[model samples]
Every structure is written in C-alpha cells, then in structure tokens.
Target: MKYTEEQLASIRHPRGHSVTFAVAGSGKTQMLVGRVAWLLQQGVAAKHIRLLAFNRSARAQLQDRIRVALPMGAEMPRISTFNSLGHRLCELFEREQQLPRHELSTSEALLKKMARRALVDALAAGNEKGPVSAEMLDDFVAFIGLAKADIEPPDVVLRRLPAGNGRAFFCDAFVRFERNRQERRVRFYDDQVRDPVLLMRAEPATAQRVTNKFDVVIVDEFQDVSRVQLELLVILVGTRAQLNVVGDDSQCIYAWRGARPEFMGRRFDTCFPGATRYTLSRTFRFGHQVSLAAAHLIRHNRHRADTLCISAPSTPNTAISLVKAHNTGQQEAVVEAIAAWCRRNGARRQVAVLARLWAQLMALELALLEHAIPYYKPGPALFDLPELAGLLGYCRLAAGTLFAEPRAREVVRAMLTTPTLFLSANALDNLVEQILSAPEQAGRLIADAAPRKAPNWKREPFYLRAELWRAAQHAWTGKGAADALQVYAVQTGLRKALEGDATDATTEKRLAYETLLHLAQASRATVTEFVAHMDRLRASQRDYQAGSDEILLLTTIHQAKGLEWPCVVLTGLEAGAFPGKRAALEEERRLAYVAMTRGRSQLFLVIPPDAHFQANMEGRPPPLHGKPSVAVSPFLYEACLPASIELGAVLHQCRPEDVGAVRLPAAPASNQALLQRYLRAVASSAESSGAT
Candidate 1:
C-alpha cells in the first residue's frame, strides 16, 4: 500500500529525535507499521527493527500486521509488550552480569508474603529494621502496591508512612525486596523498566546494546508511556536511534496506570529535538453529525491542546443519536428495544452494549432476559462468574501443581457447597474450618457418612477429602478423570456436612479427612503459581473477551478502552444512573467519553422514562430542585437537544407511554445455513440473468 505524503514525510524525515502525535481513528498502528516497512525498504535489516506495544493485544495486532505486510521470506522484527521486552532485557543482562535468578518471578501475593517474611526475619534476628505503620498499610492496600504498568516512585508509599516503626517497616521491606531480587538476578516487572533506565545511565555497554544494536525503534501509544518507558526509549534510541513515536494526548486515559500524558507535550521537543509534527485531521469512523457531537464535547475539555480542539472532518457514517429512558428499568427496556430494532433492521449480529458499570450491565442482562433476546455477552462478567473462577483455578492447578496450593483447597471446599451442589453456606464453612483445624478427624467423618448428601460433599468431610485426593491423583497422571472425580466428590456427600453438636466425633473425623485431602491436593499444587495465574486472569479476562466478535459486550465504561463496535447502546442514563451518584471525579468524564466513542456508526444513550419515580416517591426536592431539569450530561445536552432550547436542554415532556415493548424474537434459522442458501440463490440468479 502506498503511503500518503504526510505518512511518507513522517517516516522519511531525518529530523533529530522527533515523535509523531497520533489521535484516535487517525491510524497510528498503520503509520507505525508503515514506518517499519519503510525502514526495511531503506535497506534496514528486519532483524535490527524493534516494535514495542504497551499491551499484549496491541503487540499481537502489530505482529499480525507485520506478517501481512512483509514479503513471504522476510524476517519478522522483534515485537513484544513492554513487560515482555523487560523480560528479554533481563535475560540478556543476567547472562552478562552472571546474576542468580530472583524470586521476583513468584506470584505477587507470594512475593508480598516473602517480603513480610523477610521483614519478620529481620526483626526476629534483632536487626531493628523494616517496621510498617498504619499509614503505610493504608497506602499499600489502596493500590495494592504498584502494578507492572505503574512506574511511579514510592512517593505514595512514603507519604503514607507513619513515623518510626512504620517508616522502618516500609524501608526494610522495600530494601529487602530489592536485595532479594538482586541476589537472584531476576527482575520484577517494575524492576525490568526501572533497571533498564539505571543501566542506560550507568552502564555504557548495555546502553550500546539497546541503542546501536537496533536500526530503528517505533513506539505506538506514545502518550501513555510511563516515565520509565520514556527513559528506556530515550536510552535505546538516544539522539540518533531513528525514533518514531505516535500517540494522542487527548486519548491518554491511563494516568492511574502510571502514564503521564503531560510528558508528551513537555519532553517530545527535547527528546526529539527539531522533530517535525504532523496532524491527521480526518476521521474515517464518524459522520458529520456524530463528529460534530464528539467535537463539541472534546473541545470543552480544558486539558487538551488547542490543536486537538478543532472539529474532525466527516467520513462515511451516520449521525450519533440519543435515546432516552427515565429510569434504570426503563433504560434497560430501551436497550432491549434497540436490540430488537437492530434485528428488524438486519444488524442484530453487529450490535453491542457498552455500560459504565457492571450493575448497568446486569440491568442490561435483566432487560435482555425480559426481552428473551439471545446475545453473546462481551464483557468482564464471564470471568467473574463463580463457575469460571472454579474452572480457571482448576486449569492453574493442572498447569502446575506448585501453583495450586491453598487455592485448590479453597476452591474445592467452595465448589462442594456452591449452588450447583446446594450445600448451605454455614454448613460448608463449618466443614472447611473443621477440615483445616483437624485434617485427620475430618476424613473419618466423611467416609462414615452413610447418606449420599450434597454432590459438592458438604455433608461428609472425610469423603470430600478422599474425593479431592482422587482428583489430584487423576490430574497427576494426565488423565481425563479430574472432572469426574470432582463430580464424584460432590455426588458422594463428600461435599456436604450434617449439622450437629460442636463435639460430634463424626464431624471431627470428617474434618480430618478433608484436611488430608487438602494436603494431598497441595502436594500436587503450588500456591504461588495458582495465585499468579488467577491474578493474571482476573486483570485480563475482560479485555480478552471484549476483542471477540462472538460475545456481546457487556462491560462498565472503565473497562471498554480501545474497543469499538458497529452498533452500540448505552443504557440506564438517568439522573442517578449514567452519571452515577458517586461519579464526581474525572472518572465520570472519562467514563462518558469511553461510552460515547465506542460506537462506529450508531450510538444510543437511553434514559428510562420513570427517572423521577424514586425522587418523587422519596418526596425529596426534584433534581435541580423545582426546576426539574433532565440530567442529560452537560457535554451531550447541546448536541443531542435542539438549538431552540438554548445551551443546556431542559427535561422535555415524559414519554411514559413510549416505554416500548422488548421482545425476544423466536430463534431464527441457522445463520450459517441461511447465508449458504442466500449465496446459492444469488449465484443461480446471476447465472440465469446472464443467459437471459
């Protein structure tokens, strides 16, 4: 594909250390890919080109595009997410430095556990160091320490530290954590980014390896790069590393994840001294009306650069429209109504629902169930389900027993009494506690139980343990019997326990058995590994599902970054709904922005008709008190409402009766079969028409 003059200019220019600022829908990915291709064309070896993506999915996309664009025999450049890049860097640096592998690769929970252990060891040995304070604990718990993406310093930690012991505890833990990591010669995710920056500053050989070794370095999503990331990029490229960075400051929504959009505006000049700037003014996604709506909303943002304030040029699309519902129920009804409309309009397969919260999505699901509509959910809810949690835990346990540990026991106990098997929560918890407290007695009680009991084994602790042991044995042999063993464990009352006096010998025996089972499972499972896997799934499952065209997206606004759909409906847009009662922070602004921009051609923000029912019933003064203004977002008011109403639109007449019916259509003929028949008919008609 031939590049536009602008694209070529950005790629060809030899201006020192310049970065390209790319906006959403401006095709930053395509530009980055083009630059790589251009480098190869200019006699740069593919092996010497490196492409870095901030996230895994983006990395995969970059790799796919490279494969598609490169010649059949051409070598692929090194491509990786930032963490993966750090992993590579650590590996090479370790070989050079002759460092021992570190324990930082352990699960975050385990690492923390070890850190605490180190702290305890230091104190117990009369080291008089590393004391934790209440304030430091507050900070640690707030963000749960820094994410791999968060490269920010420990200022947050430092500020939260209490005097004396608290300060000492934090300092000790941090120092010990670093020492442990250094001793092992392994790098944590944070260390990967941090150490590279250090190496570039102190180690000339390492700096040369990253900088002089590569012919070109192309960075996408430059706006969200953390300070460490920027440092790594600077060291790798320097003034003459042939740098190409592309990002949109307006869309830099990852500040909480340690990204600094302001850095782009400040450092781009110094980093890429005398760099040329190119702007792509046209958007291919939104039509004139929708573009105007977006432009109107974005221009009001005080943080955006003046250049980004101008309206985007129109493209092939339709006007973005607003559909109002008065309350959450009514809003969901509208979502159903819109889904039905899409079916009627022949776009059912292309429709998606974007929500600002899981509760909103639950409202949508309830609406869909009410409408009897068949939809593939495309959000975070799937991974959150208890069943999914159980399955993933099992997978982790199976992947490596060393990772399974306490999780195996916890999940086993929970599954036995969960709704699937119907054991009471109290009964199950008592049994689990007993099993943990006295493993030997728990086993005997389970085996002695004559009743079949709950399939989850809530009745017989010993039986449950035995069953779990069997499952682990089956898993170890790589047999397909693990699921069956789980079923058996539940079926045999091994999952349940009978209610009795505290001193019941049968219960004691059952508890012992369960403990035995737990020990057996733990023998094969790694607590550290399981926790790590679970953590990964917890964070990424939503993103994994969102990319699928198969699942209907049902997610909160905060979850739907970098995703778009051909059809999108935002439901529950009432006073206490869309804006949410507590969304007073900038989170609300970003949530609305994320929800609005997810649409490709059609967008609907539904406000329920009975929005005032609660306030009216509560006898609280009406919203805006007596003025009774509709709670449409101020950002959306002007564009969605007519001009005669002036700047902020007022609540119009309530269309209480317009609460349209939500119908779940009868299952249609198989889409694949129908498509086949339609194609066959088209072919025959065309052939006959030619003869005629």
Candidate 2:
C-alpha cells in the first residue's frame, strides 16, 4: 500500500501533464486511484475528470476502487474503455452530422467469415491457379486487418497483381470495401474511431467541449494503443488535456491485434513536448529469484533493456525449480507432488498451477480433479454468450424441473451432443440419431453428455440459471443487470412464478436473479437475436475451455498478462514449445517474456528429455507435456543465473537407482491430492447434492 520514493515523488508533483510508464503488477491502478483521490482532495471536480482504460474489466475495477476509497455520495469520475469512448464520440458525430451512427467495429467473427468467402471466390475466379497457402491467408489478413467489435476495417487486397502494384491495388480495394460496407449497412471498427476524429477535427466547438469536460485524462495500458487510438486521445486533450499514460513496453504482446508499443513510447513526447516521464521499475508480486529470472530472460530481448527498472532487491527470497518429466504422465506426477507439498506446507488454498498454454495444463487438472483438489480458477469470465444462451434456453424449457436445474448440465450436454454449440454438425446428427433410436434413454443420454463436474463444484450447482445469467450478462454488458427495466422484469416475473407468495431469497437465488437480469438485458428484448448472439458467445466459451488445462491454468502466454500465481509450472519449455517453431519473430520473444514473468514465487520449468518419444502404444504423447526435446527454448539457457541449476540430471537422479532396485509405489502428485480434496469437499456438500 505504500509507495516508493519515486512513486511518492510522482504523486507530489501532479501538474498539468505527466506520463507514468508503469510495469505490470506495479500497482498502476492503485497509483492512478491515489492520484485521482489527491486531486479531489485538492478540489478537482469529478465532472471535469475522466479515466480511460484499454478494456472494460479494467475500467470496472478502477471504478469499484474509486467508489470504495472515496466517501459515500462522493462524485464519481466518468470512466470508460477506449472503444466505448470512441463509440460514444461516433454517436455524437452522427447526431451532429445527422447521419446514422456508422456501423464500425467489423467484428473478426464477421470479417473472418467474409474473408473465407472472398478467398474462396478469388480461388474460384482462378481455377487454374495453384492452391492457396496459409501464408496467403496471413498476407490477406495483414492487407486488411481482421475485423473485431469496434475494430477498424482492414484494407483490401487484390490477387494476381504484380508485387509492385500491391499497394495501389489494395488502396483501391480498400476504398471499394468501405463503399460496400456503407451500401450493405455494415460498420467496421475503424469507422467507429475514424469518423469521430474527423467530425471532432472539423468541429472546434465539439472538440473543445470534450477537451473542456475532462480536465485530466488518464490512459492505462498505453503500450497497446494504436495510431488511431492516440489520435482520439489527442482530440480529447486538444493540445492541453493533461495526460497520464501508463504501461510496460516489455509486456506489449498484442502486436497481432494491431498494438504498437513504440507509438506509446514516442507519442507522449511528440504530443506534450514538456510532459515529464515517470517510470515504475519495481515489481512487488514476484519473489526475488523469480523476478531475477524474468529480468534475465527479458534482458536478452533486443527490445528490452536492463534500465527498465525491473530489479527490486527488497523482494522475497524464492528459487526457481526445474523439473524434468520423462513424459507428460511423469510431469503430471511431479505437479501432483508439488501441489501436495503446498498443502502440507500450509498454503494449499493459496497455491495455483499456471501454464503457458491451457493444453499444457490438462494433465495437471485431470490428475487434480481425479484426486479432488479444492481451488479456484481465476483468469477471465467463465460462461460465454453461446454457453449462457444455451444454459438459459434449457433453464427456460426446464425451469423448476429436474432438467434445467444448475445450468451447467445443459452446457455439458451441448458440448457433447448439441450441434448449435460444441459438437460438429455430423457429430451432432449422429448423437441425435443415437439418442432418438434409444441406444440410450433420455436420462442416460443426458448423463452421458454431461460434463464431469469438477470435484469442488459438487457442493455448488454448476447451473444457477439466475446467477449464471447475471455473471455472463455482467461480463458482456460491463455492468450488473440491476437497472429499471431489469428490476421490473425480475419483480414481475418472480411475482408471477411465486404466484404472489412471499418467500425469503437465499444468497444463491439472489445472485441468480441478478445474473438473470443481466442475461435478460443482454438478450436485448429479443429472444431470437439473443439466441443467435449466443452462438458466437458459446463458441468463444468453448474455445476458452479448450484452451485451459482442466483445473490447471491453461492459456496462451499472451493471455497470462497482468496475472501472477503463487506457484507457476511452465511446461513445454523446449525449443519448439517455448519459441514455438512456428513463431520465430520478435513478437514471439515478447510473448516468452510475458510468460516467464507470470510466476509469483515458486517457478517450475518442465522439459521433456526427448521430443519424439511416445509414452504409450497409441502413438500419442501425453496431453500437457506433449513430445519434447527437439530443441530447448533459447531463453532457458540465455537467462540462466550465475548459479544455474540443471533439471536434466536431477530428473534422471529421481528415477530408481537401477531397474532392479526395490522401490514402493510413488504417492499421488500434488495436483491429484488437491483434486481429491476438492472432490471430497464438493461431494460431501449438501448444496451440491440438492442442486443435482
């Protein structure tokens, strides 16, 4: 809670303009909040302040902190994510220009669909041409960035054009694409930000209004800001918006999404010539060993430097351990061992197993789940649109019935058998046929399709229709569904359902009602559209689930940003796995840096002895620790400490001294023990039984 000398100095010198380049876990948000609180105490009006974040979740967290830190009824600063702000400004322009709000934000979902079609059409146009390559697809996407919600439209590409003619051809195609978008009533994200800037630039009064309304502007996650985003900020500030920019260039792992950290590093100086720069180099999250490891790993990257202020001598003492598993099974066994160690060491409840890839976490999760571990997985939102809609649909159909209780059952069913959500079209048809033919009765079919519950959830119903809905809705809507319309609907619906009988609401039900309200609000007053919207939502949900390693944390290195766990076991640190044979560019280096930095204290690096070994006759490698050893990640050796430890020899030594040596069966791994504990807790809970 206390700030360092540098942080204190920055706080003491709050002026008209400043830039704070903060690293991840430097309590950037807390500092920002403190700065705001200081200004308010100095009598800055809330109406004249605005806080802009890179994403909604960050904005919400900031807002929550502001409300709690300030006095009751204290004025709240206007907070919004960049996209939201851009969307609003676009609306204002539409009103002023009397034009329909430009449909910008060509969602990647939409563009990918169109791009595939376009690619196919282009291919058909040249039947004699050779087959398309993945590189072609990548180039095509680059020519025109993939569209996302509120993203700018990508420029178009022309096939069969000479290399020299590519630019001109794309420019023309880009213009045509924009014209087509207008004709077709579709908007891309570029239009959302671009139109607003143009409008405000042309209208001094409008720009002045925004600039004047917010006396101080704070932009977090600035390293991810695009040229377009920077322009928007400039308009709001109008050469004097008093700006604060905070982010870590080393953690800019979103270049594929159009982020340019260099722009952030340079633009503040270009925009505000006299702006002072403040750097937060100290990290309070990771232990000294882990931090040093990270610092060493990142220091090798050409884009990163030792002067980034990553060193903090005051950090706790913790060592990074390297574990070599003969195979994934062996790796999982090691994880289980560690989890057990944590529990026995008195921090079972506080430990986490973080992985660079969700696929890499599965073995640990399965081992833990089979063993019944009790732990919470915190990464991002759990239920997605498609999953939420499906759950709600089933809940609606089976409200207060055995079928619809505890919402997740329906999701499990959809995952296994429903074509509308997870199962492939053919697979779904086959499943339906099997079900209809009574190969399995409805009850059995439901059971077969059901997802195995995580041991911890046995006492907690996976499907709390109202609560699930609320969580899903809030995640999507950026707020709780407690507005007038939602409240009225809930009151009226509950009244009808209860037949006017008065009953006390339990905590779960209350949460459920709130979730239901959010879902209802997100449904946009149209059940059909809501259902349709859920497909993408469900797909994304499935993608996220697929990415995770069961109870273990599974996500891409990029996804691991802004998060740190007490214990991190990074699997697949070998050549192909770490750098990823496919990702040889500088971006891959940045991603490696991000992944290496996620550990708080205990760090375990799992390396497979060989890349081509098969653990079983099935010829399939174990799930999480797949085949290993083709190459080691360069960073592993490059970033080694002066007293570097070797895992290869240690693992070999852990094996029996000789094949003939007598040994008792090894105990279950820590992950397995944790899983067992969780399962026992959930299984014994009356709530889980009742829900089921």
Candidate 3:
C-alpha cells in the first residue's frame, strides 16, 4: 500500500485548493484515499470531509477502498454520488418546502411527456413555428438536459441556435416547463442535480446549511463535470473549505451530457485562483503497445490537455495486432481470435468485445449463438422488455382480481411501477394511496379512477388512468393467459404504441412483436403461474452471470469506461461504424483512445467486411464486395493499423467445433479440497503439511 512519489505529492500538499491530473490506470483512486488519510493526520475531523463520486459505481468502489485503507472502528467521512447527495438534502427539507415527494423522482419518458404537454400549450398559444410530432421531441428533451447541465437560460440557448433549426418553439416551452417545475416542485434527473446549485443561489439559509456541512470537498472524475456541476463545486469551495479534483483530461469522452476535457485543466485554473496542479504520469494498466497506440490516437483531439503518461516498468511491450475479414467473415474472424486468445492464455483472463453501436453487437451475438460459446452482456433482459413486461403486468393484475394476493402495499407498488404506464409521480401516489385507504373498495379503483373524457389542460394523468382501466378489464377475461395477453395488447393499444414510439429499426420492432408472440406461447398456464415462471427465468440470469470465470464481456465503448480487462477485441472498426454519423471526428477519436487503453495484455482490432452488411444483415454474410465495402476506420490508421494490413492466416480459420470444445467454468472448491491442495504443496517443501 505504498504510494508513488507523484501520488504522494498530491496527497500531502498543503490544504487549500488543488487539482490532480490523473491519466488512465494511474491509480488516482488510491491517491484519493491517501488524501483522506492525510487530512485525518492533519487533525481534520472525518465528519468535516466529503468525498463525491460522479456515479454510483465509482461511489461503491471508493467506499470499498476507504474500508480497506482506514483503520477499523474509525469514523468514516461522508461519501455519496452527487445526485444521491441532492436526494438526501431534498428528503430532509422537502416537508418544509412543500415539495411533491413522490413526483420528485422522474424518468426520461415522463420528462418528455411534460415537454410534450408544454409544446402543445405553446402551439395553442400561437408560439410554435410549425407542427411537430412526439418522435421529434427527442431533441426537445435533449436540449433541456444540455441547457440545464450548462446553466444556460432558454433565451441564451435560443440566441446560440441557428435561425431555421425548427426548435425555436422549444425555447418558449422551456420557460413554461421551468414554471411548471417550480410551481409544482417537480424535477427530472438533470433538474435534480441542478437543484442544489439553484437553491444555494436563491436562498442564503440553504447555502449556509450546505457550506457548513463540510470543510474539505474532493470530487472524483471532475473532468466529466457539466457547467452546473462546476458551479456546485465552486459553491462548496467558497473561499473557505479546501477542494481537490482528480481526473484525466485525455479520457473525458462523455460529450452527450455536456462534459469536455478542457474544463478540468484550463477551467480549473480560471475558476479557482492559484490552485496547485499535480499529475500522475505512470499507468500500470496496459503495456507499452497500448499506451503508445492510445497516445497516438488521442493526440488528434484538439481539446485535450498536454500531459505525458508512461507505461509501468513491469508491463510487457506487447504488440497490438489486427484482424481484417475480407468479406462475410467478420463474425467468424472475431470468434476465432477470441477463442485463440483464450487457448493461448489462461481461460480465467477476462476478454472484452467492444463496439460503437448495439447494432454491431447484434452481428457478433449471432456468431456466439452459432458456436454456442457462452458470453455475458449487460443489457435489458428478455422478460424486462416493455411489451413483454406489460403482458406480465396485465397477468399479475388479472390474477389479483381473482384473489386477495396483493393485500400488501409493496405488491401494489410493484404493479404500479411496471413498464407499460409512465405516470406523473404525484398521480401515481394518489392512486396507490386510495387503494391502501379503502382496502374493501380496491376492486373498483382501476375501473372508476379515470373519467371517460379526460381534462384537456394537463397530460399523462388521463392516459395513465384510462390505460390502466382498459388493461385491467381486458386481462380479467376468463380465457387462457396467452389469449388474454393477445386481447390485452390489442385492447390497450400496446402494438400501436410500439410502432410509433422511438424504434431505431424495423427489424428490432418486428423482433419485439415476435418475442411477444413467442412469450404468449409459453403463457398456457394460469396468469399467476406464468408470472412466477417469468420471475424464475430472471433469477436464473444472475446464476448465468456467475456461469464462467472466462466470461466474454459484450458491451458498448461507452459502458466500457472506468473498467479494464486482460484481453480486448474491438470489432466494427469500419469507417462509418466507429466514427458514427452524428459524432464529431475529434470526439470519436477520444472514444477510440479510451477503448484502446482498456487492455492489460493484448489489443486486437477487427475490420468487418462491411459496416452496411453487419448492420443490415442479421445472419451469415455473403461474399466480400469487389472493392470490399466500407474502409477501416481512419482512427485505425492513427494507431498505425491501415485498412490494407496483411491478412493473418488463422483470423478466419478457426472451426466452430473448437470454440464449442472449451468447457464451462468449474464449480468453486470445497474446504476439504482446498486444504488437500495446500497440504500437497507444503509436503513437497519438506514440512508437516497437516495432521493425519
């Protein structure tokens, strides 16, 4: 647990204001823990220190490390994700503020529902430019999130947009949405994070409570902060409390939520005067080859801070190789390379297959299924799909009508939170409370809750109420469960909803309906038994996650951040695939840099035959095109891997039988078995291993 000199310099610096520029795999986490321990040694109270992580996963990791680093029976400093801290503060003062407690926690869909209502009001008031549909509201929602994150007012953002962007109507609606939120005390994820910044600026008393709560504030992943987050940090660091930010400017790849790398470097200096800067220059994660490749690619990005990081001395000088499939062999080549890696190295070494889009993973998924190679992907479970979950929800509600199964409040909450209905938080609570208040009148609640013709002023309430009633009636049929589901989908307009809702591809849309029908075939038993079977299937996924130690991580590049593996197979490296259509080239290069550095031992790049083929074709691809479809990524050239690199022999040569031959991971060892292994090793060393 010894710290490097570079890390020690930052941890032991005199407490005022400082920024630790930590590169990838530079062990900044341990340095953060060390800074806390140093504060304790400087006679600072643990209660006066606050550790803020950017996300829940980072918070959990920091908490685990704190326990390992600090002494037992010691008081720990307060640790929380930024939003969770906001949630805690809201919980404490909400009663006094007269906030809508249940409605405070919202979702993206419901937020758009709010925006959709605001847009309609704007249109009626003669404020909008032209007609707009629900499909186009994605931009409206995204604009609101980005504006809130940047602390930009509607007028300011409106001035920045082009004249003919077709989104001028949203500016007026934005103002109306804020008015609605402030009047009702309702907020979504972005609003929740910005609440503290707004509240502290508005009320001096609230600011005093927050400022007095901590003496020293340290933020992890500070490079990923939005403008509002930077403002919140400034408030906490207001001329008194010591503050430290630890992050890498080069690895700031999250531009979607208003994060740019320059904020951690130049912005740090501008915002906090005379803040000391420290850098962690040695990465112990990947070897020399990966370090060089990542450095080469990221330097192309115009916005990064100029800092040098070297590979560890103990790290190997591994060669980052390439795999080019001439035609229909992209999936087959990838699977072969993956299996070859597992065989050459130990199976226990983790390998990650990363891509730019989910569509890319679809092609790779078919390869795994063909070979029956077990892999893991952190995606939506089959039963958790909206259409599927709705059917289950109906079945559960239907079964409830037959018996007194949901006498408990939690069971009712479960039914209310299902995928089909997206109600305003306040309206949902009112329905649930009524059921609890009048247990005897529960049967009539769904049927009588919504009126025939809903009011025109507000949205979500009417639709939710009406849909719940109709769904309940349709599911309550005396027919079999599958037949009831079919009736429910038709009567409740679920099919129509899916068709119009934001489906990316027609194939995916058809897939959901096909899955619905397939699920219906299994719903032959009563609705209650079918629900239990679905629950059991979900439970088995957890066991499947623990199925093998040699698990293949199938995930997107965005999800692969803040994580590393021994071997990495990056697929779909074609021109239009990795750079994507909407992303800027510089930002795309940063993303590619992040993916390259995620390896410890090997980095294998794959150029599929064609981006169009992999995305458009779901099955075995046809022969290679005359000119070989789309070229390999321009970023691959940045890594010194050109599109015309010599084709390796075994890249497309591995047989499917060899892939299927690798065994599943063995079960864990028992106590006696472990003891015998230990005894055998000790006996060979000329010692009495164990008692006879």
Best by TM-score: 3
Better of 2 and 3 by lDDT: 3
- What's the C-alpha lDDT at position 651 in model 1? 9
Model 3 residue 578 CA deviation (Å) reads: 2.0
Residue 577, model 2: Cα distance from true site in angstroms: 2.6
Per-residue lDDT for 358-389 in model 1, tens only? Answer: 44454345344434454566444533443334
Cα error, candidate 1, residue 82 (Å): 1.8
lDDT per prediction?
Answer: 0.51, 0.51, 0.64
lDDT of 3 by residue, 113-188 (tens): 7777777777767743333443346567767877787776776655543331556667788888777777765767
Model 3: CA > 4 A from native = 91-103, 107-109, 123-134, 155-164, 326-330, 381-550, 609-628, 641-692
Clash count, candidate 1? 59
Instruction: Compare candidates 1 and 3 on lDDT and give the better one.
Output: 3
Q: All candidates: CA RMSD in angstroms?
A: 16.4, 19.4, 13.7
Q: Model 3 residue 341 lDDT?
A: 82
- lDDT leader: 3
TM-score, per-candidate, Cα-based = 0.60, 0.59, 0.66
The lowest-lDDT stretch of 10 consecutive residues in candidate 1 is 644-653
